[model samples]
Target: MLNDTVSPDFFRKDAAFDELYPEHIRELSQMHWTPIDIARKASDFLAVPNARVLDIGSGVGKFCITAGFYHPETAFYGIEQRGELFSFAEIAKEEVNLSNVAFIHGNLTELRFDDYDHFYFYNPFYENIEPDSRIDYTIRTSFGLYDHYSRLIYQMLDEKPSDTRLVTFHGPDKQVPPSYRLVNNSSYSRVLKMWIKE
Candidate 1:
């Protein structure tokens, strides 16, 4: 049962939370998944009650799961293009029993930005440009793909209304549109940054 499998402490740390995944997926936690603390902090900034937050290329649903658990009043949704990663995220979400969180098996291009009030990104397209950092060979990667996705996301963020909130981890400022202003950033969390559209 989920009740038997889950505990308060499970969400407290990265190691304990990552235990929800299988060994192979767990191994990718450090490099790919969002850390628990960073997830919580990002959620705090993005999760306005009754609002929907979208995690772009949410690998294995780490950010969605952790953020949803921390901020139940807000809805957390993740979009992942990889079938294998999406499947694992679904399994983990079921195990966690978090009703406010959801996972979608599709590319970020399939998303409608109007559907969400806030956004979170962990430099999902970086893998395409950084060959050594790629998660797997399941998807094609290239500098072209990275640039395309980055421009697409920049346009998406630009189109959002004023007051839209966004959080990014390990992403460059260039990916963020100039209309969005940097509001808060955590040094301890490294590249964790919060932005607001003006």
Candidate 2:
């Protein structure tokens, strides 16, 4: 069913479309990649017409591409630390020919938090402290880095203007600033949390 053009509807239904990555990467999909349904829900909440949304640790551009498809008016940007993964994200984005989505290969520390209107975080720093959960040994993983990134994110979110939107998936709630109160919580609780700064 797949041809030159990548259809958003096909992507949502076909398992192969979601499994375009290698077996190893595909294996990580369930644990790491955001599901199509979840991405749709998150995108709807984050997309404020022309607002820009940033995925703090966009693994393979799944969240960005899916979000971009549903909300063409909103721009989605992803910051990925791993070079290989970043490359894959670029390739996938090209295949879809979506102008609203872009991927940057760099650490989250290099980005300016103020540039984005909203955020989607999927425990971007979790692999830093947990050796077993690491996607790969390619990047240096340390508790110090985890602590630093967590504190840095907390500070960034704290400084954002009121009404800034954020959606955290599989997060421990430590990285979120106290100033941002939980506006809505899914029955799934920890996995899906919607927050807005006070």
Candidate 3:
């Protein structure tokens, strides 16, 4: 059984946090889940007080849970298309006891962009283009879906009001609209970028 009283330092390492999920889910961490440190840094940039941050494809709720744990004032929401992943996210959220985090099981295109104030994306569409990166077989993957989702996100980000924050980890820069200016990023890599709409 897992510990009920999660420590304050639980955020220190990925293994400590990954304990929330089962072995199979934990195995996917190296590729799928956001590294604990990256999630912390990205959340720091995006979690303006009372902001609603949406993780475009919140796989098993790792990022959302981490962000919500660190930024208690900000609410984090993740939309996942896979029911299996969504179920795990909900279970993990309960174990963590974070009221500020939520999980939605639905397609990204079905959501209203206006519902969220900020965005976090981890190349959710990559699996569509890269055959080996898919999380599961529930969602159809194709170059066409990649193009469609990319175009849809580009246009959506383009329409957001000024100062809308966005953080993308290992994401395609082209998916971001020219209106969203890259402001800050890690010194080691451009893989993680922080952006704001002008």
Q: Which scores better on lDDT, 1 or 2?
A: 1
Question: How high is each candidate's TM-score?
Answer: 0.94, 0.92, 0.94
Off by over 4 Å in 3: 1-6
- Taking the tens digit of each residue's C-alpha lDDT, what string does model 1 give over 121-184? 9999988878999899999998889988999999999999999999989999999999999988
Which candidate has the top score in lDDT? 3
Candidate 3 on 1-198: residue-level lDDT in tens? Answer: 122344556677999889888999999999999998999889989999989999999999999998888888899999999999999999999988878899999999999989999999999999988889878787789999999999999999999999999999999788899999999867635789999999
State the RMSD for candidate 3: 3.2
TM-score, structure 1 vs. true: 0.94
In order of lDDT, best first, we have 3, 1, 2
Root-mean-square deviation (CA) per prediction:
2.8, 3.1, 3.2
lDDT of residue 46 for candidate 3:
96
The per-model lDDT (C-alpha) reads: 0.88, 0.85, 0.90
Candidate 2 residue-wise lDDT, 103-138, digit = tens: 999999999878898999989888888788888889
Per-residue lDDT, model 1, residue 47, is: 85
